[model samples]
Target: MNIKSIILGVLFLFMSGQIALAQSTGTEREITELSKKKWEWMADKNADSLAELFHDKAKFVHMGGTWGKDREVDIIRSGGIHYKKAEIHEVMVEVMGETAILWNRITLLAVVGGNEVSNPFMVTEVYVKQNDTWKLGDLTFSKLLTRD
Candidate 1:
């Protein structure tokens, strides 16, 4: 092979690799957007929409304690913990192809039994891609600050 031709072929392969890498990065951004959408539905009290985001075997560990899917549904229905508005202040996503871990800080304006409350929370959520859908595999919350 001519030296110049070989050089040109190597350059082409390198550029192709870069394109694949860029597409992979874009897919990660899409996963982060999914997390954002799910949180928005949660803040809106759209439990049905949020439900669609959860994995069937999802587990939740709240700041208070552990709870299963049934308890979570009940809490939403009974207004045990209701978010009037929840804003995500910071978000970090660690993606491993088909799975991701999301961490974020939220400023929550919540209503508990007709009383208004505010809190700063650190939340961790796991998402797994299944059948082209990202589902919440786990949710855990830690209270950074609480105001009565």
Candidate 2:
């Protein structure tokens, strides 16, 4: 292929990716916003809100252990691990039919066992739509070595 053709092909591919990203519709935006609010709710230790959002069989995976929705809500309510703040650096959401998956890069500051700690994590959240509402099905935090 000629140099000009190669360049044009590369540009086309790049623009196609951009268009796909730009085509994220209202549902995607809504899910993204909901994820952001979830982080805020965590920081505030608003277990009531979280309880409502979490599905009945929701699972939460942490660095320490994994548990179901009730335990997760109780932990938050009782301040077992207080999510002080989540400095969200990046977030991406993809919707597939009635399911949405969201990934977030964050620096999380938290109080665990009465000690303040900070960590970088790539958090994955999965939500399933039931009726007209979306409920969080799973939330898993994967610790990242670099702060970035």
Candidate 3:
């Protein structure tokens, strides 16, 4: 093969790989978006939507720094947390095969304990692709303190 042909072939291969990567990234992005929607529903106090995403053995940790699915369920069920208005400002996703970790920062205007709660927080969630569907495997939230 001529030198130019070799270079052209290499460039084609590189572009093909990039296209594949971009496609993968796009798919991963969809999964991440779904996960975010679930979180939004969680804060919205739409219990069922949040429940569906959680794996049976999923680990859900709260801003209070507590762990356990049952406890998380109890908290979710008790109705203290509600996302009256929510906005996702940023989301960063890292994917490896069937697993993904998403780091997100969201602002929530909610009603908690009958008091209006405006929370700006950061969350990290792990999602696992199972049977060609993404499910929430783990979640943690940290509240951001605002200096008035």
Top TM-score hit = 2
Stronger candidate by lDDT (1 vs 3)? 1
At residue 76, candidate 1 shows an lDDT of 70
| lDDT of every model, 2 decimals | 0.79, 0.94, 0.77
Q: Is candidate 1 or 2 superior in lDDT?
A: 2
lDDT of 1 at 25: 74
Best candidate according to lDDT: 2
Estimate, for each residue in 53-80, the C-alpha lDDT of model 2 and write its tens digit: 9999999999999999999999999999
Error of 1 at 107 (Å): 1.1
Model 2 clash pairs are none
lDDT of 1 by residue, 76-132 (tens): 756787867767788888778788888878877888778897888888988898999
TM-score of 3: 0.78
Query: In angstroms, how far off is 114's CA in candidate 2?
Result: 1.0
Enumerate clash totals for all models, in the order shown.
0, 0, 1
Q: Estimate each model's TM-score.
A: 0.80, 0.83, 0.78
